[model samples]
Target: MHITLIVPTNGRPSLVSRLLAHLERQTLHPDHVIVSATTPNDIEVRPDISFKVSYVFGDPGLCAQRNRAMALCDGTTDIISFFDDDFVPCDSYLETLSRVFREHPVYAVVTGDLLADGAQGPGLGFDEAVAMLDAYRPSSLPAHVRDHPGAYGCNMSIRAQVIGDLRFDERLPLYGWQEDIDFTSQLRAHGRIVNIGQLWGVHLGAKGGRVNGVRLGYSQIVNPIYLIGKGTMQRWFGIRLICRNLVANTLKSLRPEPYIDRRGRLKGNMIGFAHVLTRRADPEHILKL
Candidate 1:
């Protein structure tokens, strides 16, 4: 049961260091560990680790870096664990994740609780908002969140066979955002995606700078439309309904963000729509914090 750990980075040495240290401490060490940094000089792994270290540099875009790393996993690698550069793994991560997959190999994918870390009391102004968004989130307790391909890219694993025909959609415009969802949705169509509770991962939880301003729509807007455009959705969500959802979400998100002007948010969305409609807009270019 040799597992491949694939992590991608864009030159964040601090987070990368944290991830490597955590991996070194894993109870079931991976068979191979590969890091894909955006630049050649970004590889600075310590030489004393027990596993293999392979680095692929200069691959730009989210999916490209990941795809390159996957290749490094090689055909013999049985399982591949994808982690964001930011997540610090617990000692039991590999043991538990591999255990669940070994027991339930039929599922195409599995994800664990990406519990949010830091400032966890209810007093934070964004607390309710975070709750609102996560309220409907599919949990992986095995009792639930156990039979869907909708898993987060960070801290998830896939058996090599299930991933042979699937790859991240590199056509996506940006480095971050809804590419994870889109990929998961595609995997769901082919097989089951489960939440494996015995395995848990923590998100260091950086929204970048978007926390200061409401992130109007990308996940909330464009990709859904594109999914509908590609006929990937189970039901049609017309432009009108999508707009309404976007506006409603904007309001909810705006509650804690003082930087966004409510009126201008709507106005800017409209303007952005025109650009999208006129062939001048690219969802990848949307601002992220």
Candidate 2:
């Protein structure tokens, strides 16, 4: 099965380079690898690579960059995978995905497990990432493939034909919070979205080329609400997300975590909650806060 890999990045050249290095070791090489950046200078490519590599530039938004990469895929491409620039895939990542798609024709979307520091956080050196992958025992995971609610943007693949005309909702704006939910939820209507426990990768969760904590926090509150208004996310689900983040940020603010910017996020969450209380919360207003 021919595959096209799309990586949307901003200003993290080293991280992107590291991800590419991991892809080089994949047992199943992609027919093409597209690196879509916010600007031409956001990435640098090496002259030598086994597979075809293409670089494209667009406005600096995750959804926008991904849409641009999607447009660049060859017509013959069967599977199109999207991976974050900071994610490090296991050696057999593509091989596992290819096998799964070939075996399960009913699935429209497939996502894998993401490991980071024994938890779901990021930032692993190249050697460390490889070691973790070597140590992971897929046999221990449950054998059954189960239906998933939606695809995780960090490492997910979809049938190229299934996503023929669907594009991410640009209305979600920069960083495009919950854009995966908005996109994959629509894809669910076409076929099953499954989570393959055996297929796993590491999310480096590098703290760069990302928006400030305030903006992320604002989106955390507003994006879900926006999706609810758009009739994509259930109202209760959105409320649950808001409450969860607010409570987490509130608690963390009292005792900040090492990797998280708790204070900034808490301030932003409070601002968002205040806007909601005044009946003035809007996704567009998030930038102004």
Candidate 3:
């Protein structure tokens, strides 16, 4: 299969370099690997290998970068897979991924286990962590939950046709959160998205909420609003739905796990509330990509 792997990173040159090394060793090498970098210097490694790899310079926003990366794959590419800068694909990652996509002919999008690599491996498991956003697990409720499709941009694959000119919704770019949720939701609107049973992408880094604490919180709280405005919230969140999610997240936050910090989330919820009440109509204050 003519597969194109898309990676978008802002300033993590080292991670991208390591990922390129891992890609060089992949048993089934990608036909192409497209990277959207904040600057040209982000891609420091180019292994002497047979697989096609391309790099493009872009500004620092998750969805926008991803959009630029996808542009590299026009109509000819079979599957466009996305990985975060920190991900290191397992040996059989691409090989098994191909099998998953071919196995599920009715599904336009295919995603699988995103195991954490190094010290940041997902202790909660991919299913639990992926559930934090929105996704389709075969054993769960259903393959496609609603007309909206949800996917994990970090390790997700979509058939080019199912998603026409769709790009990451740039408006909710705060801390790069919720963009994938919105993207996946949109995909689900057209066709089903399936989760591969064993395909895995190892994420190498933990949540970098330490750098932009307030903004990280802001993105967390406000992304749902932007998502809802786009009609991608699954219509499952009215006042009651919002309350449920907030309470659930709040409870999850109190766990004090350094990985998922709840203190920033509480502060972010406050900022989010302020924006939702007094700043929703304002352009600068509210989250917009």
TM-score, per-candidate, Cα-based: 0.74, 0.93, 0.78
Count of clashing pairs, candidate 1? 4
lDDT of each: 0.62, 0.82, 0.66
Q: How many angstroms is residue 166 displaced in model 1 relative to the true structure, after the best TM-score fit?
A: 2.7
Error (Å) of candidate 1 at residue 129 is: 21
**Which numbered prediction scores highest in lDDT against the true structure?**
2
Q: Tens-digit lDDT track for model 2 on 101-218? A: 9888899999888766322344566678778888977775456677866788888899988997999987766778788888887888779998877688887767777677787788
Residue 128 lDDT in candidate 1: 35
State candidate 2's TM-score.
0.93
Please state the error at residue 190 of candidate 2 in Å: 0.5
Candidate 1 per-residue lDDT over residues 1-289, each given as its tens digit = 7888888877566557656765777888988888887786555667677778788886566678888888666678778888877665556778877777777756677777655643222112233323432354444454444665256776677777766667776655445445666666676644677885566656654343221112344334555556556554433433654667566646755563443345444544564566568765555545441
Task: List runs of model 2 lying over 4 Å from the truth.
Answer: 117-122, 140-142
Global local distance difference test of model 2 = 0.82
Ranking by TM-score, best first? Answer: 2, 3, 1
* Worst ten in a row by lDDT for model 3: 140-149
